[model samples]
Target: MNPLLQASPLPLFDQIQPEHIEPALDTLLRQAEDALSTVTAAEFPATWQAIAAELDVATEKLGVAWGSVSHLNAVADTPELRAAYNTCLPKVTEFWTRLGADERLYAKYKAIAPESLNTEQRQAHKNALRNFVLGGADLQGAERERFAAIQEQMAALSQLFSEHTLDATDAFSYYATREELTGVPDDVVQGARNAAQAEGKEGYKLTLKMPCYLPVMQFAKSSALRGTLYRAYVTRASDQAEDTAKQFDNTDTMRSILTLRKEEAALLGYPNFGALSVVTKMADSPTAVIRFLRDLAAKARPYGQQDVADMRAFAAEHLGLTDPQAWDWPYIGEKLKEARYSFSEQEVKQYFTLPKVLAGLFKIVETLFDVEITPDTAPVWNPNVSFYRLERVGPQGR
Candidate 1:
């Protein structure tokens, strides 16, 4: 059996390969399409449970299988895996676009009587109705066709943006001499050295991955080194990057995404994308959200201003950095924090081992939620990922 087609509760992560993607998705999508036809047939009842049993089950399987593929692509991307995902992306996108905008299915859903549903069912039905509208179920003729096209285009563009970001991030590397790595934490420097050795190189290797970038910014004594990294970090997937990196620039992609969003919003009778976004959210409108943010900023402005002033003074007097640049803030802040608190992140990290931290976290969660969490076995893509079982802490101990 294809691991993607396995009946296991969790995905068979270790067994699923790039080759399995197309066949698995083909079968799942066919099943989902068949289910949609079944549910929307003239003889079929428009009741919630009937449609759910046929349509929901098939679609859920498709979702889970696709989600697994997407997760693997994000965490453990390879050229083959990426190619497989891209090949299948448009098919998956098209199916979902059609399903959401199917007028027959929408009519069946409309035929479902709200009075027949219980409290939970009613809420679910209400949300589904709203979603169908937002999904362009009410659109007709050319407008509907355009809406579907826009969805597929947006999906493709979004995936392209993600690919560019990941590629840009992975493409960058900087090798620094031991003298250049001065004041960097011991573990980080050692890790960098190990990376360089893995590639048969002499000096320490550094990348923009957060583990290396963040600590380097905070603690590296070399201002030039910090500046070099800061520039690369900020300019990834942008035109500001070097010639090779400029190929991954998202400037045009971002503009196209925004243009499509505006068009989509207009098609759905929304003024702008922001207005459409809040329809499913708690905020009444975009204006309300903006007002709330402005109010928050007003309240926070004084403290933020004071913090900057204090950091500036500390940088000028103690560090002899009268003209601190953007890259200097994190270093100055860390130094200031260490001076005032008489502690550093490096010192704090020594006390909180991974095991100790996990124990503390689980203890707090178990106490608050009245549950017992225990280790359980499952196939994982990575060795570091451990599975756990959570049970209610009751007399029956389920």
Candidate 2:
């Protein structure tokens, strides 16, 4: 989740205050557990139809609830909610792994005749079986235990990675005086001024946030200032200024997981993890994936090189530099674009206020899909909230 869910249309559980989440999640988890228990206790051999229909009820409810909470944890972040959600994710993941790896559950699901299911139901069972196998449902004794440990560690490490990224994002602050703001555009200067005023500070404030930091790099004439911002932005994820950099201690964790996965693939009689992973993917093989990437890379390489060469020429002529470093790219590129097109991105940004851009996008979608979008008259949450319901029309005027 990216701490910016303020702009999203979807409901968010993490932003709904701590008191609300526990009760909702508890109720939802209980409902899912009860459904799964009932399905497991049924005496008759499990058919795909019965299992698919029953499983969807439990998983779907849990999915919607967890999706909202996890999404909010990433975007519209709260420290307390992030802690609670991180605590809950392991339990939820373990539950899913256990349920999928359950021998009785797999027996019931695997017993169903393929032909007995409708297309969707058939696909559901196929997916269920696929997940079961992935969860080490078919493995026994040592291999299964190994797989479980691998999964648990991987989940923890992934969470750590995200937590570190968030920490890095929230760490730095930028302040500049009016004199320092000389080369910045008026709106950008105003934005920085507003930010500083918000914090009751004397001058402009900027941070790693794209909205604030990017404009200064793109338009600010001070090479030193641009270099400073660029360095801060790039180094944010390192251990120096970030508390969450501990999350990236996952190098060992990932290697351990990958090693176990490769072993698991071998036990299941696949050559490697890639072979195991792509079994259900469209590309079908690692060779196909590599070929696709290399082909696309080759096609783009010439154009990309030319762009680099043109930029180097422009920089050499204007800035008297033989080679342009990372910090020089944006400032130089802005000049080059203006030199060629007589148009600048900062100048064009006035017509693209967030609301107007959104409205124009909605208009385009409406034209293509023959749908209308209108704001909700009243809402429970934010005053900025909007709701839309879509309906598809028939071909004839019925």
Candidate 3:
């Protein structure tokens, strides 16, 4: 009865129902346990190549299920979906950790002939060996148990941090009556009006989503309105008192994650997680990354300073204001741009409808890659969404 392992013939497991996730996960977990046991109990020479191949297949199957469930939870969150996802994530992590910590499996992989593998397979085996070593595969008795406990606890804490951040982001909303929305441009004002109507309200309602909020704050000419939005954005997660939750505050969670990551890295024999993570990325060291950022800032500093000076002078000349506040910056900048260039962003936006924008993007990509994307008319997750298949072109200008 597992949803993911169903016998239906829908590509990408499209027929998977939400109701089947819990039972499917239970079944999948048993299968995973059996696979791990079988690998660890093998008597013959257990090769890293064979072990890694099995691991890849098992992980891929479980990963498909986890990915679908997680995406559903993010986009269409309900209590049922949320509960299933939160409960399942830790189980998945524990399975991965258990396999990573298996000493017999590690020993078998360690015995593989390096000369027998190709370039890619050799790299994969080496990565597999590194994972086992870092995961404490060589530890015995109490040390192994302690490492498992640490990994599981870390997984749970990371989940808790993300859930708290999502809750905080979703909790705040603002409303402004038509009369109070005096300085907003007509298209944006109309958009807010439409939004209010959709929600069965008489006034505009602005939430934290970029589509609903950022444009209003950036273009609203009223300083009071901009300041209110800016303040809400910054103080969202502050603690009002000891017990009460302030607006969107993520302070304690941020501190918790930082401390946990440092501790976890130290336990794994790394100086810090930054080195553990970024040593594999394009930038080799923290010093190099910092230098890159500093160089960019230095390049930008003169133009930024001159722009700030020009804005202050313009605001003083037009509004008779001696001091230019941060709240006034966006509105005045827009005005300056329009006056100097005789062009407005809103006018440009009129020609770039969403569908037109997407079509243009498709054309650009097609020209670069020489691939074709034909739209399929099928029932999809959203009515506005379209699905395209990327087909490879043959060589010799096919």
Candidate that scores best on lDDT: 1
Total clashes, candidate 1?
0
lDDT of 2 by residue, 16-58 (tens): 6644555666666776777777677758557765665776677
lDDT of 1 by residue, 72-144 (tens): 9999999999999999999999999999889999999999999999999999999988889999999999999
Provide the lDDT at 19 for model 2: 48
For model 3, what is the alpha-carbon lDDT of residue 373? 66
Candidates in order, TM-scores: namely: 0.98, 0.84, 0.86
C-alpha lDDT values of all predictions: 0.95, 0.73, 0.71
lDDT of 2 at 98: 75
Off by over 4 Å in 2: 1-15, 239-271, 367-372, 377-387, 396-398
Candidate 2 colliding pairs, count: 6
Against the true structure, candidate 3 reaches a TM-score of 0.86
Compared with the true structure, what per-residue lDDT tens digits does model 3 show for residues 1-398?
A: 45577543222334445677777777777777766666667665466556656665666667676777777667767677778877787788888898887887788788889988889989888888888877778777876787787788777777666676676667766677777666677877788778778979888876666665667666776677777666655555555312333533556767766776776666667798776666457898777888999999999999999998988888788856578676667778877777778777777878999889988998988889888766765424445556776666658543
Q: All predictions: root-mean-square deviation over Cα? A: 1.1, 4.6, 3.2
Candidate 3: worst 10 consecutive residues by lDDT?
240-249
Better of 1 and 3 by TM-score: 1
Runs in model 3 deviating more than 4 A are 7-18, 44-49, 138-143, 183-187, 198-200, 240-248, 319-322, 377-380, 396-398
By TM-score, is 1 or 2 better? Answer: 1
The prediction achieving the highest TM-score against the true structure is 1
